[model samples]
Target: MCRNWGGGPLLVVECESDVSFSGEENIGLYQSSQWAERGFCKQCGSHLFYKLKQNNQYFIPVGLFDNCEGLVFDHQVFIDEKPKYYCFANQTKNLTGAEVFAQFAPPE
Candidate 1:
């Protein structure tokens, strides 16, 4: 996340289904990891979403939405990798990178 998202905490909305884009020509995809890819806007270089290679799951940055009325900051991932300079006051579920992989990684 840090390597792709300009080295900061990125708030993303995880979607279980495929996210449709109106301007497909402006979207650029980079294979960020073995299991996923990151999408960006080619015209403005704005980071779009991180998508799983194995599924339709997409982690779209919350900032892209026009209205954030119902969104909740209930959980966080890669807690161990978060920079020590910033902190959150919310009493939410947090998971380390290893814990995330353990819970979501497919059985081999």
Candidate 2:
């Protein structure tokens, strides 16, 4: 989806399931997995969101937001999966793929 995002880090926000927008019919829904769906704008094909149906969690692209003043750069997941060509200077908590999966897993 970086093609639509101009090839850089993508900031995002996690939102609840009930989030909605006006003219939602113009958005396209893509099935990314058994439990996840990716939404994009139909006209421009901009990557909009990645939604997990099991928990009704919507991971939204932060570029769409108007004000992000209160947000903080927290954890970076799948750090090991990132390409070696680029890196971030921020000293933050980083998680590997397995750790991210475990973090998102439901507690017993």
Candidate 3:
């Protein structure tokens, strides 16, 4: 959510598993919404990840990685809420917020 990050879109890479941190104890978790939580560094307050409560899935910022030579720009979520002042040039599979919820929301 852009509003959460000082009115800027956060570019993130989604990971379902195999994510680890060096100083794991320093990361603080905040319940940002009913369905999601946000992780950040406790010391300097650097944004770490946005995690889904239902599945423990993590959406980590792309800038956090030391090596990003092989990453690809494939898909983007929450396309409908994108600000009019900016747009990405990548030809990505864009999904609106509702579409993302419909596809990933846990079963009742």
Give the candidate number with the greatest lDDT. Answer: 3
Residue 47, model 1: lDDT of: 90
Q: Which stretches of candidate 1 lie over 4 Å from their true place?
A: none
TM-score of each: 0.90, 0.82, 0.89
Please give, for residues 44-91, the per-residue lDDT of candidate 3 as tens digits.
999999888888888898998898898999987898988788888999
Model 2, span 49-105: residue lDDT tens: 888867878888888999988987787777877778888888889998789667665
List, in order, the clash count of every candidate structure: 0, 0, 0
Ranking by TM-score: 1, 3, 2
**C-alpha lDDT of candidate 3 relative to the true structure:** 0.85
lDDT of each prediction vs. the true structure? 0.84, 0.77, 0.85
Q: Which stretches of candidate 3 lie over 4 Å from their true place?
A: none
**Residue 66, candidate 2: alpha-carbon lDDT:** 93
lDDT of 1 by residue, 24-57 (tens): 9999999887778889999999999888777768
TM-score of 3: 0.89
